[model samples]
Target: MQEMKAEIATKNSKKANLLDHNSLKHILDESVSEIVTSRGYAEDVRMSNVRLFIGTIIIVIALFAQFYKKKFPGNRDFLIGCIVLYIVFNVILQLISYTKEKNAIMFTYPPPGSVTSTGLVVSSKLPRFSDLYTLSIVSADPKSISAGKPVEFTKSVTQWFTKDGVLVEGLFWKDVGALIDDYAAVPKKKK
Candidate 1:
């Protein structure tokens, strides 16, 4: 536990500065599509995880029904229903994932949870995933809405991921933060 805390503390200590709503908008406008693309990849991962979890639960329930058939009067019918439900659930999840993937390919106005009054309170933090680490950015403040929202962006920053991927070790945050800061510094052109 102490070791875990120490690791997390170290990661947090190395985090980049937060960019507010205007900064984020500037970055989005001027920067390449890589950030949006990364968001798509992250969404894909999130949806896959959801599918895996729910599928596992469904399978487990079906297995239980099979094993304890004598306990349930309509075991066969329940199993059939589970199979149908699983199929329907998967189809719906797939359609949703497809839509999100397609939408992510293009820039969208007023990101989810946008607010005129509060705007956005942005943050970038390194969150622990088991023994690995990921950088999570909350561009829109979930508190602005009654129901909270998930992180707006996330990317793996583990040693292997950093080594093999585009992000370099020790300078990952600097690279990403630079893009935002640089863009945010530029004056907007009059239309």
Candidate 2:
């Protein structure tokens, strides 16, 4: 309890700078495809998990229904019951996973919240980046949207990501440099 609070306090103490026009611009330019990839990745994961659950249910039904197979002889009330249970359970689990994924994406991006917090305008001036989208660095502060502050445009690199906010276990964005440098390094991957 206290330990966790102390850790969070320590994290909040770190300074995370705002991305400069070039760095932010780079992310903005590349993000059209990245958003597509992230969205698809989330969708794929959801589908795969649902498939796995379905496969497990099928196997369980097959195994259990067999023991009851001979008992019914001509009637298949047990087998029918198993199938019904599988479908009902699958629907429930699918809804749960869908809700979980939506929460994860919203927590990480918080587009609606970030825009209001940062005071960044999407007027005609910032042309290379689209007026349709908003880009923000994760804030060092847990309680507020700390991106787009003037201080962020300078050289500071301290940023904090609450794992709960990032929402997936063992995942976080460490800093603005990591954000820009990490993605920029990807083009060098081939040959």
Candidate 3:
């Protein structure tokens, strides 16, 4: 883990330039394609599951009602109730997913000099690994790179916090690049 972190911090050869804008762009693109997109896809699958579960429940209830010759106000009311439940549950899920997406893409930048810090749990390492790389992109000159915008990716446990509850500092190269590409407020110069 430390080795990987070091590689992210300093590339032994000139092959990987972590500091360059193009590298950042690459990281951001990979993040969107791998992390963010997967998260969105998972949410979609979850929504589909909700739909399937509701449909199954509704059918089971309708079948039972018919088999038992049960009547509630009218046969229509039973189906109507099931349909209402389906809509309500699906609506709630949609609202939750939407809220998450909104929160995830918060491209916030404080005053240039102001410190924007988040803690990360490092193994036996003092305090945390500073997410300097990610935060730096956000803090750099407006002309250099676009910072604080809603992250295109979902805020997962790995992305948001560590096992011990510390907020993970820094982002994977993929996340940094993807974020800049998708959410950078100022246009980045091609180097």
**TM-score winner:** 1
* Predicted candidate 3 versus true structure: per-residue lDDT over 9-55, tens digit per residue: 44522232333434433443334334433322221243345646766
What lDDT score belongs to each candidate, Candidate 1 first?
0.42, 0.39, 0.39
lDDT measured at residue 26 in model 2 versus the true structure, 0 to 100? 40
Better of 1 and 2 by TM-score: 1
Measured on C-alpha atoms, candidate 2 has an lDDT of 0.39
Residues 43-120 of candidate 1: C-alpha lDDT, one tens digit per residue: 224444676786787677567656864555657677677778767767766776565332232322233443322222
Q: Which stretches in model 1 have alpha-carbon errors above 4 Å?
A: 1-64, 71-74, 101-170, 182-191
- Tens digits of per-residue lDDT for model 2 on 1-191? 99999789667542222333343334332432244234321112444466577778867876787766466756477779887887886786677656543212212232343233322211111233332223233222335544433222222111222323221111222233344333223233466
The root-mean-square deviation over C-alpha atoms between each candidate and the true structure, in angstroms, is 13.2, 17.3, 15.9
* Estimated TM-score for each candidate: 0.34, 0.28, 0.26
Q: What is the lDDT of candidate 3?
A: 0.39
lDDT of 2 at 130: 30
Question: Runs in model 3 with CA error above 4 Å?
Answer: 1-74, 103-191
